[model samples]
Target: MRRLLWPAAVLVLLLALNVFFTPSFLAIQVRDGHLYGSLIDILRFGAPLILVALGMTLVIATGGIDLSVGSVVAISGALACLRISEDAGVLAAVAPALGLCLLLGAWNGFLVAGVGIQPIIATLILMVAGRGLAQLITGGQIITVNDEAYKMIGGGYWLTVPFGVLIVLAVLAITAFLTRRLALGMLIESVGGNAEASRLAGIRSRGIIVMVYAFAALCAGVAGLMISSNVSSADGNNAGLWIELDAILAVVIGGTSLAGGRFSLAGTVLGALIIQTLTTTVYSIGVPPETTLLFKALVVTAVCLIQSPSFRAKVFRRRGGTAPPAAVAEEKARVREEVPPDGVRS
Candidate 1:
């Protein structure tokens, strides 16, 4: 319960701000009986961050980060848009695009895992260079496609639920299955908790590290497809600008430590939701655009402080809370208390 302090605090703050600034922010209204309003917009548009953060949870869990994901998003969107044609079959268009994404993923994996380069330094190469590659692919122009099947990746509806939301949910479900059903958590923890110890235990840490980066690239690809669908055009610059910050912010806000250890996918999902809601609230209420970034920064800092070791200890000691000796058990107990009944804790 205590482990969840920071994420819960962030969720509460996001909700409170929405309610105070935008009276109907939480109220999901219907226009002509179809879903409409601030809440829906938050859910629909925030799907991209949710997808990116899901991959980030895995990478950060292994004591690494992938800075090139934004670039991957751009490349994936560009490829998908460039290949869209009135004559191409659905599979012809989408499969090749996703294949390119997987190749990029493999490349990232090779650089980070095979070459023994630091995650940040390795991903940075792609981050700086991949955008230029994407622009070159598009001939430095935004490509708009009119393919119906491809357009549905982002703009289609699923039984009144947005396809974008469904895609995010599908990825979340798969991730949950891998982590929970397969006990992959133990493998990840072994690697992150102590790489030397895990290697001694015969766990292939390098492969796992590569897998994490590859998985991150895969996620960015999905996000790119969805984003381009929303706009009906592939604009590399605007598709996922500064979203790496948002992904990092979501992970931290969701209670996943940047230092890397145990992780919570559920918490990350909620963190993404909170971020979307905050942005929607800011826009709905017409707050000065200049203050929005400042406000978000302040909120992130506050959440991080709440999760910091010093503050946690201070609150725990002052409140006379005691933790069990086993580190894993202690963290789990702490997380439970921090998570609200209505909110997910990372």
Candidate 2:
């Protein structure tokens, strides 16, 4: 129940906010056979954050963080837009765009996993320099690409559903499959739980870490493509700006602690949805657009605090009058197991 509390709270908060701000926010329409409005927009815009959070989950599960993702998004979008502008064949350019993303991921992996650098510090270098690379690609200006292929990636739809959202779902499905069905979650948890122990156990901990970082870049690449498609242009300075904050917030809000350990893809999805809903609620309630971010930050901070062990315990104690019997028993059992017996077990 403790593990479930945070997510459940967020769900209720989402519903409440929707009910108060937009009466029809939860109404899913199949009008002309299409879903639309704020709800759909929430899902659509939240897709990229969902993708980023998926990769962040793996990286965090490995006891690492990738700050380079926002920059990677900028670079990928800039490069792809530039290529299409050059009139390079669609496949020819997109292939290289993807290759570049993969290579960037590899570079991040090499630095953090192979060179023995702190993940945050290692990714920081790219986070700073990568934007400059993107600026160079776009000649310090937003570049518009009138490519049909690129448009399909961001703006095209299938059966009246957003293709970008579908892509995000596909990535989510892949992540869920890999982590849940393949025991990858166990491996990641083990690695994050104890990197040295994993190394001693002959696990390819470094390789795993590298793969996670690389996957993060790949995720960022997809986000960049979608963002560029939506605008029909790439702005290195603005594309995915501050998205790292949202990604990290989503992960934390989903109950994936930043300190690292286990991860939940489903929780991450719900987290992204929560964020989008909150944003929608804020906008619908007529808050100034500039203040939207301030509100988001405050809400995220509140979530992080609530998820903190100390805070949760405090809250639990304050509400102890209504403590559930099952929870009390579980707490007692945990205490007994944690404490040594009065005498030796033998």
Candidate 3:
């Protein structure tokens, strides 16, 4: 919880800025029995990112990365939309798409865990190959579907709340239970902390690594479905372009170590919300559309620096005109050694 303070503060600051720009930014009203507000929009649109980051958090905790998630997102949506366009039922289309995502995930896991490939390189292979695979599935075209049932997953409302938001909540709860309630979280952390030691301790580190990658892909797959379903189309070339970057950013912002070990799901969700809110802020504040990415990059960089403990320690030391504790202790020891028995300086 202490680790989350900085991120939470930053998110609040961003939201406050939005409130200043748009007075009604935080206002929520029920319209036709449906809740509507900027905050709601953020949650609805950011749902996919939240899911992707959740999976990335787990994989990162296990000392592995999955660069193929963006590609998996593209492939999942493309396959689902393509099947739907062929007059298949929504369930039929979604099931196969998710299954393929699982297979792709397992294949990535196999490469990294079984064949001993580096996680980045192993996933990167699929990252590049999967795009072509998605294009092939779509015949180099955007597949659009008119299935109302499918739309409900991403865009439709239920009980005055976005269904996508509900999905995120459900997924979050399940992930929490699996990792926290069960022994899975400890196992993942042990492997991440020291893979060789974990293996020696009979933890089956390889299997855990494979499982995390598979889980990451599964989350990406669900995100893909939500995106395509909301838009009612899947552009193989652009469905989930660069989403992995955002997911990684969210995980880092949420206080997850890229080096792997401990993770915080709540922090990841907050991080994702911060990012989505930042995007919304850009538009509301009237920043130039062309410069939006640059603006976002600058803010994110500042947030990261603020969250860095080393950076803060240096800043505080400079402001307080004090050296670090180690330096001060060393100086004290040197002075003590130099002093004579009379308790005076040499």
Q: Give the count of colliding residue pairs in each prediction.
A: 10, 0, 0
Q: For candidate 1, lDDT tens digit of each residue in 1-346?
A: 4556557677777778778876776787556535776667777899989999999888888878888888888888887788774466656766776777777777777887788788889888888888887888788899888877777788777666778888998899999999878968778856766666678889998888777878888888889888887888887666677787899888877777676767888888877887787777668678799899987777668767766665555566666665323443555565664464656532
Candidates sorted by lDDT, best first: 3, 2, 1
Residues 1-346, model 3: lDDT tens digits: 6678889999999999999989999999999888999999999999999999999999899878889899999999999999999999999999999999999998988998899999999999999999999999999998888999999999999999999999999999999999999999999988877788789999999999888999999999999999999999998899889999999999999988787777899999999999999999999999999999999999999998887766665776898876567545544643454454678531
lDDT of 3 at 265: 95
Off by over 4 Å in 3: 323-346
Instruction: Give the clash count for model 1.
Output: 10
Off by over 4 Å in 2: 1-5, 30-33, 307-309, 318-346
Q: Which pairs of residues have clashing backbones in candidate 2?
A: none
Candidate 1, run of 10 with poorest lDDT = 322-331
lDDT of 2: 0.80
lDDT computed for candidate 3: 0.91
**Which residue pairs does candidate 1 place in steric collision?**
1-333, 1-334, 1-336, 1-337, 1-338, 2-334, 3-334, 3-335, 4-335, 4-338
Q: What order do candidates take by TM-score, descending?
A: 3, 2, 1
Could you give candidate 2's per-residue lDDT for residues 132-232 as a string of tens digits? 88999999999998877779887777788988889998898888888889977788877776787788998888888888888989999888888888889
